[model samples]
Target: MQRTPNWSLQQLPDMDMGQFRQWQALLEERTGVCVSDQRKTFLQTSLCARMREQQMDDYQTYYDYVTQGPLGAIEWSALIERLTVRETSFMRHRASFDCVARYLHERLSQPGRQTPLQLWSVGCASGEEAYSLAIVVEQALIDTGSSKRDYGIWATDISLQALEQGRAAHYPTGRLGGLTQAERNTWLTDTPDGRHAVLPSLRERVCFSRMNILELAQAPLRDLDIIFCQNLLIYFRRWRRRDLLNLLAKRLAPGGMLVVGLGEIVDWNNPLLERVPDDRVQAYVRRDSSESLE
Candidate 1:
């Protein structure tokens, strides 16, 4: 009998269209992320990277392994961390933050408004967006002479590892591209090894947790003052995007602000929400009961 070869060290075979569709369907069913046909290589690479670690060779074997049950559920969690796109930085979109600042400034100017502003950073990977919001809110309060008003950020993502990183609140200098020298000095603490950590004041204001936007119906978040859901809907189908926006709209308090990526959506009509027209940013402001859509 011939000796069997060790298949684990062998390179992955070219993924066929059927296999690609299988994996894509699995991802979409579980996570609502629709992988395009062109992203076959991306899916293969992500699957194969994990497979190599487990010493599993064929995509079929890996597929079986990932769909097996309680074990599969555990494995699936690990896989998504590697698969999901987490490329984000501090203030990835300046216009959205500027819009947020304006909203907060208006609220701060209101008379007898004591409620601490509640904000949610949906799909917040590694915490930069959340921390940036904190910085923006801090600056906004100061700029509007309402320093006494309080606010907090609920930063959530599907990846537990990312959430842990968010909780740690440390970031490399390279990721601080959007921060100005003054903002950096005021909001971040320098470490000896060259990384910057968020200041305690800012860190304390952000709460990081693992959350899946697909399961928002069960989520504890409600009556949020602002919801920032940018750069995330692009992976979802149009109907799912509308579903998510509708769910997010329900979570917003009256007069709340919802900021999404520009051009990610168009004509998402909701009677209670009106789009804030800006040349650089796309946003919606929730209306009071009297302003319901016709």
Candidate 2:
């Protein structure tokens, strides 16, 4: 009897510079993510893993297969999911969330503020950031004696697999380190399988959607009260990063805050946004029309 080959153990041939460039261009064109020369091995490994699963041995053939027609589109989705990184945790950046809490306090203090606050979490992986935002908003409302205030969080990512995980709102116990004991007690319920699941009260406030960063211009979210886009721009070219920030600026409501990962972009400015001048966080606020006229 003939032996079936163990594709998992099969050695993938080295990807040459030409092949690397082709794959790199395809990723950037489709996802706005730049794969650097240093990440060549990473790109190769991801491609090889997917190629092995597809029983494809040739690089160019697999590349063509991912770019062709309807079947190619499905394959591309799987390939892109492998390429994207989804590492995240609840309240990953404390200072940034602190900034958000402060902003919420001020907004809630305003007279006749909007009934429901709108928040967006760009590149939200597995829903941690979105749920964290929900926690902050809910706490702020309670502290300010505005418990009846309504709010919504829009969490978006490019990977469908990640979005599904976000929708599930279940996480391993190890991933809850960023949450305080009180927070965990309030927002999480113990799962039978040694995991923590976000309580439905928080989950219902967030809507997870698959969104390609390059296609933000067409997204219908507008006048958002806050936009948290962190640890995402590092994968894109500087120009594309600036372009994405500009589009985000357009989506912010006047006086709305935008937070990004520090050092992600340099010398970037938007006419409608003013730097928040907080040393602890890289953030900006959309200028109110009255402030812009001054």
Candidate 3:
């Protein structure tokens, strides 16, 4: 193990190629996130941040500490939070939520649907997308005269820190940029400190959980009506991207929808699903038996 003198957070030593490869492989194996060579500095910086917190200097030592035993699992959790990007905003992807609203409007309008609408927000960083989804669905039900239609969201992310933030359901004022004044008034209450917190009623509708997308096969809660997974596939390899989609497709209920970022995948075809017609929305719908594309 190579040792180094005391170093400040801003003065991180360069990571050697071997060390980089080790980390890249570890990240991919654990979370399915492919860290390219171009991202070597990013990985180094993230690693250094955690190392500094633990007063650990050598990369190999830090690696061993994070991989050795039970405590290693805890360290891994802390490290993964720093490794994963959590940049998100409420209603950041309007088209996808709009598509969901339209679909739910049509579904709630029909009779004989007795179960509550089920939704899942994969890689739901900081709860914005999940809460945004709740607002959209709630609004759609109101517009369709089905305001009492039951619905809930399962927001999952690989970062426990992010999940904790999501469960807090608090946001700064400008963070809700895409939301209208009316929506803010209806769903959020301004804190004494000038921040905004989601109303308890809205917060109660969402359950946040820590989930790694790579563990899709072992994930609970199937037969979902909507699964919104956006801006996540880019971190994974192409083949793994398809594999994830196949896994996600299995979780969808009949006529359920799967939404991804535009251009994240190319030429991916699943016979059991059909692309949503709206050009503005990057989504697909699970095809039920006897259902044909119009």
TM-score each candidate: 0.94, 0.95, 0.94
For lDDT, the strongest prediction is 2
How many residue-pair clashes does candidate 1 contain?
A: 1
Task: Look at candidate 1 and give me any clashing residue pairs.
Answer: 271-293
Encode model 2's per-residue lDDT on 49-127: one tens digit a residue: 8887887767888988999999999999999889996689998988899999999999998998756999999999888
lDDT of 3 by residue, 1-294 (tens): 344456753578668899999989999999999989898989998998888788777888898899999999999988998999668888887777788888988878888888899999999989989999999988988898774759999999998888988999999976796888899999999999889999888899999998889888899778899999999999999999999998888888888899998889989988778999887878998988613322
Write model 1 residue lDDT over 1-294, tens digit each, in one string.
122235466755678888888999999998889999888878887887777677766777788888998988898999998888678999889889989999988978889888899999999999999999999999988988885748889999998998999999889988897888999999999998889999999999999988888898888787788999998999999999998898888888888999999999886887768888786998998986623221
Name the candidate, 1 or 3, with the larger lDDT value.
3
Which rank order by TM-score, best down to worst?
2, 3, 1
Supply candidate 1's per-residue lDDT for 220. Answer: 78
Clashing pairs in 3: none
Error of 2 at 208 (Å): 0.9
Instruction: Identify the leading candidate in terms of TM-score.
Output: 2
Give candidate 3 misplaced runs (Cα > 4 Å): 1-6, 290-294
